[model samples]
Target: MKLELLITRDAWQTQVAVLEDGLLVEFQQEPRHLDGLVGNLYLGRVSRVLPGMESAFVDVGLDRDGFLYEGDMGPLPDLADADGIEGKFRNPSIRDLKEGSGILVQVTKEPMGAKGARLSTQISLPGSYVIYLPFMEHVGVSRKISGGERARLKEIVRRLKARVSGGFIIRTAAEGVAEEDLALEMQGLLDQWALIRLRGQRAEPPAVLHQEADLVARLIREVLLRADGEVLTDDAEAAEQARDLLSSMGHPREKVHLWPGKPGSLFEHFRIQEEIDKALRARVWLRSGGCIVIQSTEALVAIDVNSGRFTGKRSLEETAFAINMEAVDEIVRQIRLRGLGGILVIDFIDMTKKAHREALFARLREALERDRAKSRILNISEFGLVEMTRKRSRRNLERVMTGVCPCCEGRGRLPAPWRTAQMIAETLSGRHAPKKAVVTASQEVVRFIEENRDRYAFPSGISFEAAETPRLSHFTIRPAS
Candidate 1:
């Protein structure tokens, strides 16, 4: 499969599209002014420690305080009890800290909605080939790198651990990397961590110690460096910067290409904008005439699969299985494209055959394996529902591209015309009914009242007036002259 990265940079923001086999699989956008906060390190002062919640709020110099849970405070030191037994370990608690105490924390998740940024004391510095864990002591390799290569990388990292101060996680890009290269990157990260600590010690509380790299550099390190791909960008300056970054990372700079296409036409040229528009919609139609309706609520996302127009020339069980199997691919694709996270409930058409259900579950698991975000999929329940969860670090595409609908107040529906008519009738039939009253409402509501005139015993002096309004439920009954 051919993999490519399409980067479009403008004054407002930068957009990146990842295509596999000429199809868009993932998309990301980063604003020029407000880069993401994830991976940033700050020296924060604890402002509030809530022992009841087992969490604390640290003043990180942001609009809102960063939230730190006890579990994310890193590995606890083994404290001995009165018996002084060596094997016993004490769990860390939030009560150990007091207000106004200083803590060096890293942002693990960005501030979402009304919530503050999620912070962790266990910091990990990501490099091109390896991630340096300053607090962790274990050496591990990427699960994607398997067989003999995994053993080789593990052996290399274990040997390098003797020289480095902290643990190391071998990235997938380091699968075939030489031991010397890994050692070089590991040293670089260790030096970086040292600088962060020195800065935190010298700086005042609530000060920023380190900021993550820009979007381009992060993309190269995390995405392009891991795969064999051509990086095409419309911005000449960005292209040069990408080449320089790749060269600094010990990779060939030739992979970065300058696209001579029209300015602001890169995404349009690749039809990525169309794909993005489609992803924002609730209903997605599959090639086999099956469709999936995705609705995101405050608590979880619900996806319903329907056999729209495709009627299989097979048994009932076969048709249900076919639609579900096809829906799995689209569901996974949409999930990644939209960057959906948190709890997700998938409702698939029911199939009676146990074998078919098992096969469907297997296919879904296989498809989700390609997703970069960490996800957990539960076995399909007897009601043919699949419950899953995906890690969400940043805002999804829909939230970024669109705002809540003001007309419906984000409910996506309006009051029915008949319902509005009932409200108008109730006002007109009040005990202090006006001798002369005018009912003003949207054209639909007015028409409903006029058509169902016999249904309501409104005051004889009342008159109906249709007016243009944004909401059908908006109506007013005022005394007329």
Candidate 2:
């Protein structure tokens, strides 16, 4: 498949889009001020501990509190340094934690939506192809290194693990990685984390102790190399950045391309926007006349498959099986394209035969294997519902591109203005509310309220606040007696 990446960097934020065969598969936007905070290590303080929950709230100097659970903190070992400081930790209870305690932690996951960051005491830093785990001691290899390369990579990590004081996990990029390359990456991570520690020790609470890589570099580390496909970019600077990153990692620069175009936005040159729009919609039509419906929620994404206009080309069982078969591959790709994670429940056209279901699961698994994001399939039930999960460390593609829906205020729906007005009227129908009720709303919604003001009974004292109809406004009710 032809893969492309279009990067546009401004002083405010950097945007990257991954296109497959000229179709956009993923889009990312990272603001300059917030940057991206996943994979950073910090020396944080325990701000509060809830023994009931067996967790602690940490002050990482971030805008929100970072959560630390019992499973996350691990155990402080009885093996202690002479200074009474812990050399290791045993599994400890929540009561072991106290406010004002000093702890070293790393961001295992970024804060998404209203959630704070998910943190771990096991800190790991990435350099080019190797992830350095200063607190860990084991050597590991990317499972992607198969056959002879897998054995060779494992030995390399084992050898290095003995020499280094900490642990390291070889990345897929480490396949065929030279010795000098490994050494440099080790040294770089060492120096980088050393500086972070130095600065963190002196910084006060709720401050940035360490900054992760820029959006571009982080993309390379997390997505570009993992995708194992061609990289294309329109922005000149972005092209150069990719070249340096790939070439330095012992990959060929020929795979990276500098796109030249000016027909509308550069991302549109590859139809990235169009594909993203489909992801936002409730339904996606397949070329074979089949269709898939995707619904996202606080917990998971649910996808439902319908034959749509597609009648089985063959017999009844054959048609259902074939359409579902096609959906297997498409759904897997969508998960990666959308960066959907956590629990995913897919409703496929049911098949009567067990062999068919098994085959379909095999096909789904085969497609998902290509995804760099870690995932596992539980099973496809008799009802044709397949459940799986993709690991996530940051916001998915949708959240990265779009903000909350204004009309729904993220609930996905708003009460009709007329209905809302009636609710207001009912509240003030009898009980005397303030003199004038102010209805603040978006330009569109406010217009509806203004035209229907006489409809809802208004109390005498009720007055509407500056009801210019907020750009994306809200409503206030005034009871005119």
Candidate 3:
């Protein structure tokens, strides 16, 4: 499958879209001024220790203090158990960390909403072929690497583990790499970590020791290279940076393209805006006339699938299965496109046949494997609810693009203005009827009351006047002689 990465840089933010066969699959928006915080190393000061929560608030120079959980405070040793499986050592408690103490930490997750970034004392630096864990001493390999290949990579790391102060985790990209190349890669990572530590020692508390790579470089190193795709950017400066990064990494620089400024946006030119619009909506329709509704809560994301307009030629079970099969592809795509993470609960249409249910479950599992984010899917339950989770480090697209609705307080609904006006009229019609009643409401509500003024027949001396107000739901009454 042909893949391409398109980047558009504006004054405010840099937007990235990944396309497979001309279809937009993944999208990211990062502001120019405020990039992501993940992977950044900071010299933080413990601001507060919460033994009750087993966490601490750390000042990392951000507006809000970062959160440091006791579990992430240190690199607990890993030892092999009798069963030959690695077991974690005891973790340090939050009480061990005192307020005002200096701590070296790395941001594992970005600040979301009211919460600050999640910090970890066990700092790790990731490279193209390996991740250098400064506090870890165990050689590890990617779980994706299996069989004889995994054994070979592990042995290589095992031989080199004692050479450095920390251990190395062989990444999936290191497969089949020459020993000399692996050695050089590990050395480079160690050198970077050394530099970070050197800088951190001299820096004051709440200072940044290391900043993660920019969007273009990170995309090239983490995504584009793995996907083997061409990178296209409208910003010449960004394109040049990508070229430099790719060339330094021993990858072909020609794959990076600098698109000349066009009359319209690159997103519009590629028709990616349409797909993005669809992603913002709660409902996603499949070509087979099935629909998926996605709703996100603070705790989890809920998705419901329905057979909207699809009626099949076979049995009802077969029709539901077919629609569900189509929904699987879209559901996974939507999850990636929308950047939805955390716990996910999918309500698939109930299927009576056991075989059909199992088939749908298998299909969803296969589709999710293509997702880059780590995810776990649970077996469908009796209620047809499929529970799953996707690892998240940054805010999702909806949170970034939208805010709470002021009118409905984000409930997505509003009380009918007509009904509200009718209630006011009824309340004043009884013994509390005044000589004059002035109803102040939104423009729509004022018009509703004026058009239906006859419905609220004022008593003989009573006068009614409709006044428009900016507040959508505000209403007022007064007595006039």
Candidate 4:
């Protein structure tokens, strides 16, 4: 599919964009110092346990405290009768662990926004093709690999894990991989984990015991695992490093090619800049001439579909279906591109025919399946709203690249507030209402009107003052003027 990767590292941040078939599919950005720790294992101390909430606050050397709930805790007893502890583990409270208790933990989620990092006491370290979990003792292959290959993979893991203490989950990338390669990955993970343990013993509580690999290494180990695509980087040093890393891992040298663009960065060459321009807007245009409007709040992201100018050859139902069908592809792409994690509600144009809805849902899932991030679709509501959530490990493309806007504070758009109040004053002055009249707006708009009372060139016959107007959008006028 011609997979392309762009790696750019600066003094402040490291960014990587994964492009599939010349379109930007996913991107990750991380500060140079606080790298993502989704798979690394650590030995950390329990800082606080709240029995009331059934959650604990842990200190993992990050700026803020991490959260560990009883639900996120893993691996309670499988059998109930053998151990009376089984029932206790069912809804185990964080109160079970006292402060100062030592436990081996792994980062299942990265620290983002106001929330602290999420962690698992069931420590696991992932290799290029395997995940080494110290809590469990078993050998398993990726579910993506099945039939005879699954058996062969299990056998190889069993052989390599003969005397190993922890468990290994064979990654899907390990499919068709040679036994020698698997063994090397196994050894690499185990060795790295051992080193991390040594550092943890010597390091202090607020220290970095183990740091995950850089963006270049991470792309090779995590992203670009499939063979059907190419990795393109503009930076000469990063390109050479990627080639070396991929070649060392037996990836075809020809597959790792330098981006041969005449001008600008690799992102510009891939038309990623255009894709990004499309990404920043609330309205997204589909190739079929249909479009979608996305609105994001702290609670969830809402997407509304429209047919735009794309007209079909046949019936009304057919035309609507075509635009909606086209929208399904763009919707999935936007969800991934925006890295909009958490609850996402998509409002597709309702279809009267059941067949159209089924087709739309199928196409949507088919598109979303390609995303490496985990997402679960609860159901397509009777109102035609599709509900889903994407798993966010590292910072999404937008959060990594841009900060909240200073003027609008990430609101994206604002109406003229002071001007609106002035217009209202003029309308009220011309039309005499009851004995008394009032004007209102946001505090900022009100302040502008009050401060600019003499400054306004409007006739003195109209008088205006700002008041607490609950419904006013900033910089917007009222009275329909």
Can you give the TM-score per candidate against the true fold? 0.92, 0.82, 0.90, 0.80
Predicted candidate 2 versus true structure: per-residue lDDT over 117-142, tens digit per residue = 98877667888788887666777888
Candidate 3 lDDT by residue in tens digits, 1-481? 6888998888888888898778787888888998778999888888999999999999999999999998777753222222211334446678877799877788988898899999988778888778888777878887778999999989988887665567777877777777877888788887786676667657788888889987766766667766578998888888888888777667798999877668236788898888988899999999988899999987899999999998888888888888888899899999988889989999998888899899999999888876778999999899989999998877787888789876777888788878887777777777856756555567777778768878766555544455555446767777664
Q: What is the lDDT of candidate 3?
A: 0.81
Candidate 4, residues 129-152: lDDT per residue as tens digits? 888875477787765789999999
lDDT per residue as tens, model 1, 1-481: 5878888999999888998778888888899897779999988899999998999999999999999999888743222222221223334578877799777788988887789999987778999999998766789888889999999989988988875556889888887888888888888887887777667657788899899998888877777777888899999888998999888777898998888878998889899999999999999999999899999999999999999998999787898899999999889989999989999999999999999999999999999877778999999999999999999887788988898777798899898999988887777777886879888899988888888889888778889899987777998778898
Where in model 3 is the C-alpha error above 4 Å? 76-91, 260-264, 426-434, 447-468, 477-481
Give each model's whole-structure lDDT.
0.86, 0.74, 0.81, 0.72
In candidate 1, stretches whose alpha carbon ends up further than 4 angstroms from where it belongs are: 75-91, 431-433
- Positional deviation of 346 in candidate 3, in angstroms? 0.3
By TM-score, is 2 or 3 better?
3
Provide the RMSD of all predictions against the true structure, rounded to 1 decimal: 4.1, 5.1, 4.8, 7.2
Best by TM-score: 1
CA shift of 51, model 2, Å: 2.0
- Evaluated at residue 386, the lDDT of candidate 1 is 99
Count of backbone clashes, every candidate in sequence: 0, 37, 0, 9
